[model samples]
Target: MSEEKAVEENPVTDAEATPVPEAPRPPLARRLLRSRTVRAATAAALAGALLGAGTVAWRTDTLPLAGSSAPCWDSLGSGSMDALFGDRRTEVDEQSLHDDPMGGTGAYGQCRITSYEGDRARRQVTVNVRRLDGLRGTDAQDWPREFLSSGMVSLGDGLPGMASSSRAWIALPQACTGRDDFTGPTVVDIGMGRADFEVSPDEAPRDRTALTGALIDAANGVIDGFGCSGTYREPRDLHPPVLWDSTRTSMFCGIKGLALPAAYRKELRETRASGEGGPAQVCEAGYDSDETAVRLTTVTDPALSEIYSSDALHSGAPVKGTRGYGKIGGNRAVFKALCQTGPVMFVLEQLRPAGKGSRFTFTRDLLPAYVAAEAERIGCGPQKLTLPAP
Candidate 1:
């Protein structure tokens, strides 16, 4: 049986045992092309690439996404950015003038001029003018306006032009009655440089003229008002003389003189001589403890010191050292000082900041010469003239 095993069926043929030979692998490109899924995928990919390229070309050709406008692009011209942002600015022209609501009677004018002594770096003087009209009340309100306007406008336009320009603003109201009892005049004001002036119907022409002349004179020279003079003193002085007129303008000056307290007056009188600088009563008002007295112990004598401390406790003893405290709005302290000086009153205010001391010094030093020059131009007598309502 063993030998016969050789007769057992011949070993299986290699062909029958082994599997059939496989075809060679296809190239990557060929494989892609052959399969429907792969081919479709490739076609889709190509279409996407073409679309991207078209988009880029269109953007570059039409307008760049960055820096889309010119360097000088303005919404005002194109109305593009303006439309987006909303227009907020309005145009204004100098040719247009608004009509005054009060029957077109109100008008304004201004003038300014600068006097240069050297090159552009050096300026010797500046004058300004301002004028306003159509007011209906007290001269007090109008006087200040006229003064300031004439001064300010002179700085821009010459003094001659300022006077001429003011004429247009001088139309008076039709029959302004004193009985109207109105608050004050309505004024339209203009400014040139530093000076401003306004005039109501109430202001007298003579007063206006005087003020104008004074302002012009001041531009050329020196002038003082409201306790401020064209004069100045050395900066080192602790207390310099003030420019004040007790005889001319008495309202503020009188009030100032009477404000001293009694205690201060007693101290000043006792310490200083009677005539040296004692307070003197200038007005008709009677001085009695009942009317103006603060307390029995503390009094403002109104004779020695326009304002003084009556109580020895509150008198000279420093409140917080150099700084003293007094009743607010009361002139007891002032009166005490004035009583010591008598009828005359003085106010010493700095005309300029300490750093600009030179300007003040120059003004004072040249004041006499300036005043003389001003007298020739405007006449030296009183410029103000009072006239009854027409």
Candidate 2:
């Protein structure tokens, strides 16, 4: 059988003979080119080897790679704010300015943009921020009266960093040193540098617009770069020594530490007096209705105890318990209550039906309550609340 098959295959023509089979596998070069993992690994190995040999690959940067140099840590300095001065083209001579732009400061830092070569005239901007020491609210107050025309700028809420700038007159030598008498607790004060002698005295300099603008810009830049958020606006509960010391405030009101009736609100005007009698705080009412108008005043009447005494009640202001009740006399139906607490006094007067006035009108309410209430509010202890006798 094998002889017959060989004889048949030999007789077959080369075309009819099955074509010799090619190699079972691809060539070494083809095999290598077809493999993705092998190609990538080989390329990486070649690159590392070249780098080790101090030879860089051509168009290496064009190749998409991950590793690169990182940035340096940012520096902090209140003086060298050159990077913040985007408007400053060329650096000129600089001088340190020292002045409390806002009055009553614990500490202050100031820097100036002495000179810069810009499209406009040689302008300068000074950025000054005075800390309030152990306080917080002054930083967010409106700009000083000097910059009254200038508006307020806020970096939104939560960021205490805010700024204000104005194009104000720099009167040659008079204001050459900037304002030295300004007062307040301002956190960020950015204004044009007044040291520049080339300024008009009568009117604001025309080129100073840029200087003022630069101050505002630089101030914001510093706040952003230095992470100065939540540092400017402080809404504090500033109260006078006595609530009545303020003519208009939460502490001073028509009723004893309480708001007046809406009808008498419009007429609630405060009047205060301090003299030989003592210090008295008062709130007088004004109304248009036929209803009675009340007048609440604080008097330093020296004879307060004597006048409010039962003996003096028949003649002058009368006293009953902690209050003195009486009429305003004549056809006017107004009654007055006097509460003298040591040296301080608060008087409450209520309007009544004409000719029918009674001192008990204010007795129902504790007119003298605030004498103790205010003392307590101020964290005072054991005040002489008992009324003094004649």
Best by TM-score: 2
Q: How do the predictions measure up, each by TM-score?
A: 0.19, 0.23
Runs of candidate 2 exceeding 4 Å displacement: 1-88, 92-106, 118-121, 131-143, 146-150, 164-186, 193-390
TM-score of 1: 0.19
CA lDDT, every model vs. true structure: 0.21, 0.29
lDDT of 1 by residue, 55-92 (tens): 11011111212333210100011231122112332221
Q: Which predicted model would earn the best lDDT?
A: 2
User: Positional deviation of 390 in candidate 1, in angstroms?
Assistant: 45
lDDT tens digits by residue: candidate 2, 43-162 = 554446532343322211112124311000011122233323443553322111122333331223444444345455464454444433212223211322222221222222222222
- Over 4 Å off, model 1: 1-104, 121-242, 245-252, 255-259, 263-390
User: Global lDDT for candidate 1?
Assistant: 0.21
